[model samples]
Target: MTRTLVVIGHGMTGHRLVDTVRDLDPAGHWRVVVLAEERDPAYDRVRLSAYLEGHSRTELSLVEPDFLTDPRVDLYTARPAVHVDRKTRTVRTADGDEIGYDALVLATGSRPFVPPVPGRELRNCFVQRTLDDVDALRAAVRGGQPAVVIGGGLLGIEAAHGLRLLGMQPHIVEFAPHLMPTQLDADAARVLQRGATALGLRLHCGTAVTSVDAGPDDAVRSVTLANGTVLDTDLVVFAAGIRPRDDLAVTPDLERGERGGFLVDAYCRTADEHIWAVGECAAVLGRCHGLIAPGYRMAESVARQLTDHPAEPFDGTDTSTTLKLLGVHVATFGTMPVRDSQAVEVTFAEGTTRYAKVFLQTSTGTLLGGILAGKTGSRTELTPHVGRRPPADLEQLLLPD
Candidate 1:
């Protein structure tokens, strides 16, 4: 008897699960169906900003033809899955196709959060979340137009950089006081801001767009800020924040977080034992890990258990991350954000705007977390220390007094 497996949401995490399952059981005893809401089979959402910045889609493919002439896997693109009835163990699609499954994986992923500001519905106002969203933003900025991006996170910075490449003046409006606030400490954030500015991106820190104004009836004229300053723009791109897609979590017997993410066990099992979910949609250890590595681990474990294979429960991971924006490199790892009250601490911060900061625990040498401002070159190598806090020599190492 062939075991059946159905994966909803063919984002990177979903497709990766399909491939991993096939590898774990090469005998072809598992039926894999991947339903993607996007029109094209999954490429890579992590590099979507790169595509928006002018890179070709072929550069970001995990698998060229999706299956490359293999028919064992069935992929449905632009098709949204509507209902999952655990009673019958079936998933119905928006396209009127019902798929019965022995087991299910939900990788519904996350969506860009657009705040309810006035005039957001105006033409040329866009949200950059998917390839479709990127394409629309590109189309909105035709003929060397200027664009204002809302949010200063990784996606927003990437979108702004990409927009600049297309000859669109890219400007960022951030509610936070600095760039990449969540990823980098205050000093590091300022350093990153300077790097972007050197690249010709306008940074509006501690500022937010209150309303969008349509020039005529067809395009955005400008964005009105809380400071009453209007920056003229031909297009508006919202890379604001991400919210887990949990439209299906409202049903009975399902556990969900206050912020709209599904609650899952260490094995990635939902409240319903027969069903499992991973990726951004599932919150693990009281945190929704938005990185790719964690989501992939979740998927691998869920599939293994269902097939009667050895499965490792997610013992929890030390969340550490490092990434490059335009040309600036920045990193954050492990327990860097812990309140100083719990751990011995050492710090060094300096910049004209006071850019870089590195936090370390005093007594027990742990990487804890680091913040980089002007030059984040050390972050790439030092980030791994975040998971396992290294020596307190971090202060003397990064900066010699």
Candidate 2:
């Protein structure tokens, strides 16, 4: 008899799980059901900023033309799994439909974290997350309008670029002293700052938004900073961070991580043996893996478990990133939050364009981590050497040829 597998939250990771299971269980051992809250199917959220560059919804889709039409797969669009009845092995949808399943997987991703500043709910204030978000931003933004983006992380920079592409004067406000504070060191951030400024992005580093002031119509007029300076803008985009969508994991039996993700074991299984979780919603070892690679890995691992295939335990993954923002390349990999004394730091920079830094164990020449800006070829080459002693000279590795 074929077992039924119900997957909630049909985002990128959820799609990966379905594809993996379908490929491994070719004998039709498990029938699949997917619940997607979004009207559109799974799309490449990594390239969400491309919407500003003339890319349509169809261009960014991760779903294949035939994947949804599979006989064994039942997809419900715009229907979210509102509640899970684990005792009866049933999932209740937002439309009051109850679907039964033998096994359930939660891949409910994350949502943009909007700060609780005053006037944040005003019109023209937005957060970068889904296609609807970008579309709404485009509708609100006009040519030559001033725009302010809060938080100078990856998403913040991407929002700035996207606004600039739409002909808006984009300004970035970051509480941290440097841009991409979590990924780039000060030296690399300086170079990236120069690149971003060259693209007409005005940045206000080391500043926090105290409040967003609105006009008489209750629309975003300006943003007040912690330093008593108010920036005039027509639109405000918040790209501070993300919080996991762990509402579905609130059942008494299911456990949750401290940071608001579904608590899962080594195999991405929740406390209940029949339930598993993957992606931002699931927390493994008490922390959520928000990146794509780790989430994909979890999806694959869970699929193997369901198919009775030999699978390795889902340990942690390398939190590496490589992307271009405003035409500037930025890459960071491995352990980046180490203390100065923990590893020997080697850096290379050329003017305000290129910057590179590598952390290594000086005694054994073992690579620990690295950050690269303006160039990223080294990231791909050096990633494999992480935790392993490299054959080449450390200084030569840091320098770009």
lDDT of 1 by residue, 1-401 (tens): 78678888988888778888877777778878888888877788888877876777677677656474556688888988988888888889998888998878889999888989988888888887777788887776665666899999988898888888888888899999998776766656766777788888988889889999877565688999998989998788888989888786323446776666778889888777767788898877556777787888888887687666899987554555667776766665555555644555454655533334555556665556655544433655566566466655665545445
Per-residue lDDT tens digits of candidate 2, residues 1-401? 98899999889999999999999998998999999999999998888888866699999999896797788899989999889988889999989998889999999999999999998999999998999988888888799989999989988988889888889999999999999887778888987898888889999999899999999899999999999989999899999988999877335568789988989888898888889989998889788986888899999999999999998888674688887777788888876745856678877777777888878886777878888888545677778889997556655665657
lDDT of each: 0.76, 0.87
Which candidate number maximizes lDDT?
2
List clash counts for every candidate, in order: 14, 0
lDDT of 1: 0.76
Q: Name the TM-score of candidate 2.
A: 0.96
Following a full C-alpha superposition, what root-mean-square deviation does model 1 have from the true structure?
Answer: 2.9
Deviation (Å) of 208 in candidate 2: 0.7
TM-score for each candidate, following the candidate numbering? 0.90, 0.96
